[model samples]
Target: MAERTILVAGTYDTKSEELGYIVEVIRAQGGDVVSMDVSVLGDPPGRVDVGKHAVAAAGGSSIAEAVARGDENSAMQIMARGAAAVALDLYRSGRIHGVIVLGGTMGTDLALDLCAALPVGVPKYVVSTVAFSPLLPPDRLAPDIQMILWAGGLYGLNPVCRASLSQAAGAVLGAARAVEAPVSGRPLIGMTSFGKTVLRYMVTLKPALEARGFDLAVFHATGMGGRAFDALAAQGAFAAVMDFAPQEVSNHLFGGLSAGADRMTGAGRAGVPQIVAPGCYDLVDFVGWQGVPRRLEGRPTHAHNRLLSSAMLDAGERREVARAICAKMAGVRGSVAFVLPSQGCNEWDRPGAELHDAEGLAAFCDEMRAACPANVALHEIDAHINDATFCDTVLRLFDGWLADGTLTRV
Candidate 1:
């Protein structure tokens, strides 16, 4: 019987021999090997489908043509684009168990894109000459994005390469055998939070959720952090969503602050019980007074730190925000509701605070009432979402939904 396939990737033209050697190592470690010939010049040392050709649609050039052009810059871009097609194919075919790649900056760029296409958990090792720097890719291209660094591009570094190859082979096999069971618990409940806004979700909402036998995963509502929360929510990982930061909505509606996901509210769809609170919808967050964009230079701004400011939201943007909220509310699978902190949303948005603005607040609330589906309970709680008393009442409502499957606000 044949063994499983391990994808070996690289600029096969430049590093064919090394790739072949690595392939040999992979096979010896009890795996069949497939090669993605991401080369620009020479032929791969082993059986390989030309990378440029496979990736042709992505880069609009044949591998041979890319090689003939002899432009490293163009070739690298072509290779990166092409790699996407090849990796996608490999993944769909289920022919790839693990992947190992080697490259310089161009090669690395191309391969990382391919790596990014893989699932969240996979054994992916990069034997690169540029691993010394701390410049890991931003998107976490591969779950296991390790590298073998050296001055000699994947070629001259034989000893280190051999060690990494052996280790990588074992690592891949071990990963397949020892797949980590997902954290055991309820569907993931996304908890949105900022340092200042954590009390509502953590102190108030989280315990309440657990009391109802729910397992919660909290997400700090930093720039991209909210998306991370939403991602988990969308995956059906969370049975419920406790969104306590409506302030992130400010960032989503207007270029205001480090808010939630770009499409922050999309996760409130079918498959989860969500209690949405616009906890921070009242203000726009910016980087300090100076970091405020020129167009926003004169807006009411509260300096929160050397690099942070909360600019008050405008009635115009708030109108759009109300629409956004209504759309999300209308799509809720279970009962979906929005809570309004009557006194304030964020710490700075309270009366006499820097973000105080009655006009903008009314516009948002009124719009919400007008646009939101009648099924969505709209509450203008007399107290803030984080106040202990407010939390108790909110949880009482949330618990009823969790237990009886009832929808609507008290």
Candidate 2:
């Protein structure tokens, strides 16, 4: 195989010894290394391939200007922006196959920006003191970025920190060499849902969509999964999207497990044709490990697992969710179809189920019908969301859209 080049980046002024050790290990493993220094106030003992001046200039600032700001936060923001721009350029130019950045909290913040600037398949790793901390929000994380805790290496490299750095170096190189970047062999269909227990339509729809000469990518509707789905959708990565389980919309609005405020807007913004539904829309998930919040104390709740629990939304909240969905759909630039399964949205909400609420369902349905914009095609199906009839309705609509040129065939 050809030699893979990995970009080693960090605040070299402070962590030069650590960064150098990583570079040395990569070279020892027969991988090429390119170093970048993102320091604002000081310089590395030796020069880097990309200097701090170039990084600052790429960010539309100067090293002198960054230093003049005096505040460390403001200065690091400039370095982060510049580093992201420079790293993206390296990837686009085929000069670097992977990147590994080392830092504490400030460095981790910059690492997030740099990783987010690259496309999804590229290898991006962060060796940080704050790796996996709650201080890092889910929305800021790139879908594929890896993080390893920089244990015992915050100030200087010791045996413990060296162990982490060595492993990170090897991992990024191996990932770059082994990664099979996403290929567009067939038209891709991006879908969202929870597990089969709650939303089982994806189980049937996956094989069905594949048989129709398309690839189906189902994203779990949890916080980070929806973030990944939305990120990919914003890049116009899908030929069409089946956004079947949009409960993340409610999660975002109610401070549940949110995928950020931009949830459910990705495909629409990219002008990709979409078919949407409200599967599991009546529940708001919270971190079960943290216990139920005070506000949700009286609501009907279901504990899915140790990690996740959900509470049923009241009738008023259901109406609010319906309006939110309609408001998001109003801005679609391409064709959109809204399917309202009248019987039930999820298995938990079916007749005699633990979360069955007829009044709340009725309120949601009424508001959806009343608020659905004129531009969106609303199909109020009599079947439940998990029913075969609902799947058939979706397939029929998909086929018609392909035939009518609303969606392109692979």
Candidate 3:
């Protein structure tokens, strides 16, 4: 029943009127608002609960020096660091319940850094002119940020801008009020897959894992989802990871969407028990509407939706990806298993399917077997990846890992 607090952060020196209006909207909606000024320029025109001077000091700099230098980029960077520190303090002290930020490229950049410091489950929204631009990379964006394109939100506030701001305020506060934090007393298992064609094993595997007292968290193998999974895994957020799809990993290597620099190796580097598979390994995803690369025009592909397309990999590419996976798994200190479905990686890669490439699969398997390390066990199954038999094999191996202390049972 208590009032929720929302942090409204922006460069008050330039966007004072807009930010002030947002604050008023939040307060009118029965929410407490905290105004943070991240400007490193001239004095703020209005009242700011958290001023630029404090922000500069928190970032290990002084406002006077930043202003004197007159460098927009340098000042913005320092202010971002300071704002993040202040926001973290506010959240820890229970003074802020959610965050709403608005800006062009500069404002959005600062907001991204600030929101990244807050843990997941905190509602964070941004209204930005560049929300859908390709200029912003996935790694630069916080996984939980809900962004709305700042259409008509330019120099001054208009009806269109106000509508966007008001809606964003409502969304953040409502989320903070209504959404309960996720509860799972059992150990969490992270799994990755794309669409049904690639990960039908989830239908049976999920309940089986739950019956054994483990909660499964599945990440779609989209570029962003894979990166988020890798980030969380590296943070030691899960006890084990079933990385059943490495398509995003291949996608990244080829400059496609959802590929972080360290996608597949996070669990291994964190020493978390991991069972890796080449689910959808024969495909790299791209936007379905985007122009296909001239070199890859002849490769087999499947359109999963209006937005997503999966392109088949050639034998050379498959071999390289296999080597990459092996090299990464070799250094794992935790228990690791490399499971490959011999018949096919995904449903689309099976016989009679357009993406089915036996030669490519053979090349990948040969490279994987030759390059797999002694410590990491490699299991080659005759069934397709989604087949119940394949899932059963994975479950059995998972149980063995638990019994042998490879994966701790919570």
Candidate 4:
């Protein structure tokens, strides 16, 4: 509620003065500045350096030297540890309203370690040299993160970098002023969704989730998003998971572009009520006209757009996907339910489409029977995932789970 305190953090041992200049610019814009100097192996003399002591407090003694002795990897590990510790310290002390860092590649990753650790709505911005990675930046931000990268390590605060970074600082400070701080989820529930099919859910589920007096978090159905839900479920961040789009899991099995790390849908653990559905499992998505994989080239492929693609599953692939899905469902604790939409899972999976394969459905069901636990339940509905019936079913199951949550005894 008081004025926001911005945290400008970096390896101050070397770039102390440089970062200080940036901090001065931030202060000039009317803001409080707390400098977190994560000089893991070294602490340059600065008026307000706060890293060496913080790192030592977090369990590292002479962390900077240790980092220097080890390879850059080790240095980064120590630095990340030090930065995380410093950021947490500053955040808890109520002095850090936002965070900023400046460095080359090492600094970029190092600062990112801290920036990427925060929950949404805590203003975060980073200046990095490697801004070319095609993958989206970390999700520590509700709005997209602002990244500034230069080609070299040394500069006298060039006009472009200064303007860009100053803009970023202004953005961070403005965001802090305009927004109320975030409240972490209570009895957190994780849901997997895609921007497409599940977009309407924001209206339907957001209020219901908030009204239940529990925190509900929506995880994008990108490969990493699904994996994140599983990990969060395992972490007990939430006692229940509502998995709407099982596209990531299907991608892992069927060679889709969204195929991320394995164990895609394993949110049910030790008794978490995992109400799941193969929402987009109806087809695998690809990029480009070369959408069909070699194995499936002879099968059926549909061109959704100039660069986007979808493929119909034959009976065999569907069975394989079902087996994988069942395996994931079996990992959950207590009652695990995977609802199937018979009318259509995706646009291409409906009647009169190229993927209306009942054989595939039968195979998936049979596979679940063979692989899932006895307690796991399956409901086949005569509607698509967006249909009224499926949505209602999802909400009812979640409410039931909240009332009967047993995922974590503690």
Candidate 5:
């Protein structure tokens, strides 16, 4: 394999020794290194491949202008923008195969922006004091970035921090060398669903779609999974999308486990044709360990595991969720087909099930029928979402789209 080049980025003015150590480790592993300095006030004792002046300039501001702001946050923001631009340029030019950044809170803040600038599948790692902390919001994180705790290295390099830093350096280099970056080989279809316990359409749809000459990538519709699905969809990664498990949409609206605000709108904005269904429409998942909120105290609840619990929505809330879903699909550039399984949306909500609520399901279906915009084609199926008939209905629409040239083949 060819020698990989890794970008070592951080506030080099303060952490020059530590950053230099990371570079040395990468070089020792037979990998090349490109150093970037994001310092505002001081300069690194050694020169960097990309200096603070160039980084600040790339962000549309000079270091002098950033210093004039007289605030660390403002100055760092400028560096963050410039660093992201420079790093992305390096990746696009095939100069850097992967990136590993070192920082505390301030460095981590900038690291997030820098990593986000790179495309998914490129190796991005952050060795930070705040690694895996709640200080980092889910929305700001790059879909595939990895983080390692910068343990015991808050002030300076030590044996403890060296262990973490060296491992991070090696991991990024190894990942860049081994990664099979996403390639456009077959026509890819992106689908979202829960496991077979709750939703089973993918089991039937996967083999059937493959038989028809397409590859399907199924995304678990939890928080981070939906985020990844949306990220890939926004990149126009799929020929078409099967957005069947959009419970995250309701989760976002009602303060459950959210996959960020821009959950179901990616494929639409990118003009990728999509077929959507509310696979677990009637239930909102919340952190299972927390006490149930006062507003949802009396609703029927089902504990899926130690980490996740679902609460049934009432008839009124169900209608609200239906309206929310319709609102998101109203102005899409691509074609949208909404499949509403009228009998039930999940196994927990079927006849004699723990979350069975006939009245709520009927309300949601009715609201969906009334609220669906002219741009969206609504298909209301009589079967449950987990049933074979529901999968058949989706396949029929998908086949028709492929035949009519609504979806391009690979």
Candidate 6:
């Protein structure tokens, strides 16, 4: 194997010793280092292959211009953009295999944008004081980022800081060395799900799709997972999409467990062949141990685990969510259809279940049918989401699309 190059980025003016130590550790772990300086206030402390001036220029400005303005916030933004451009160029040229970034609040903020500029498979590690904070929203976060808490990294080198940095160096380098690009001879199908109980039909659909030479990529409907699914789908990563668990879309609409503001619309916008389903749109998730919301205290609720609590959506909210889904799917250039399971949408939405709201489901179905565009087809199956019959119907429709030239089989 050839020597792998790792990009080490940060405020080299202040964290010079720390950045130097990181580079040394990555080299020890068999990774060649390419240093990038993102400092605006002062000169870098050591040798920087990509200097602040070059980075600033990549971001559409000059270090001199940024420094002359003297606004720390604005200056940091310019550096961040510059760092991202440098990283992107390096990746495109196959010069960098991975990235290890270090910072506090300011550094982490800059690193977030830099990491986002890279594709999903690239290894991105951030050693930050604010690794697990609400300050980093989904829109500002890269789904595959590996963040390590800067336990004792606030100041100069220490035993604690070294411990975290050493592990991070090994992790990023190891990932870069071990990971290879994804290859699928068959068409890739993106599917979304919450849990086995919600979309158990996946067990059946997976085999059927694979038998037809399609590669199935299932994504969990957790906040970050949904974002990754949407972002990747929009990037043309998937040939088709089985967007069953659109609960994240419902969650975002009602300010619940939002995947992000840009959840259900990506695959449609990208014109990917998609089969949409309201798999778990009947409920929105929240942290269970945190106690239920005061407004939803009286609504039907189910605790999937200590961390995940789901609340049933009411009739009005369900109708609105269905309308939103229809609005998103209406503009797809490729074949798109809604596979509505009339018996129930998810496990807890079945008869006698805690989240069973027949009235709400009916309202959702009505609104979807009414709002669904002429280009989009609606298939209402009189079976539960997890039922074999529903899976059969979905597979049959997909087969029909392939046969009719609506979907070109790979």
Candidate with best lDDT: 2
RMSD of each: 6.1, 1.1, 2.1, 4.6, 1.2, 1.5
Where does candidate 6 clash, by residue pair? Answer: none
Give one digit per residue, the lDDT tens place, for model 4 in 154-260: 65566666666677677777777887643353566778776653335545776777677667788866555665566566555665777777777667676676535
Model 5: ten consecutive residues of lowest lDDT? 290-299
Q: Go through the candidates in order and give each one's C-alpha lDDT.
A: 0.65, 0.93, 0.84, 0.66, 0.92, 0.87
As a whole number from 0 to 100, the lDDT of residue 108 in candidate 6 is 95
Please write out the lDDT profile of model 2 over residues 110-138, one tens digit for every residue.
Answer: 99999999988899999999999999998
What local lDDT score does residue 350 receive in model 5, on the 0 to 100 scale?
A: 82
Candidates ranked by TM-score: 2, 5, 6, 3, 4, 1
* lDDT (Cα, 0-100) at 261 in candidate 2: 88
Q: Which stretches of candidate 3 lie over 4 Å from their true place?
A: none
List clashing residue pairs in candidate 2.
Answer: none
Which scores better on TM-score, 2 or 3?
A: 2
Better of 4 and 6 by lDDT: 6
Q: Given candidate 5, what's the lDDT at residue 365?
A: 92
TM-score of every prediction relative to native: 0.68, 0.98, 0.93, 0.77, 0.97, 0.96
lDDT tens digits, residue span 118-181, model 3: 8766898988999878878787777777998877988889999889888888898898787665
78: Cα error in model 6, Å: 1.6
Total colliding residue pairs, candidate 6: 0
Tens digit of per-residue lDDT, candidate 5, span 128-240: 99999989998889888999999999888899999999999999999999998775678999999998999988999999989988899999887888888988989898899
Tell me the TM-score of model 1: 0.68
lDDT score, candidate 3, position 151: 76
Residue range 286-390, candidate 1, lDDT tens digits: 667458776566778766568777766678877887787677667556667667666556666666766678788778777877887877777767775567756
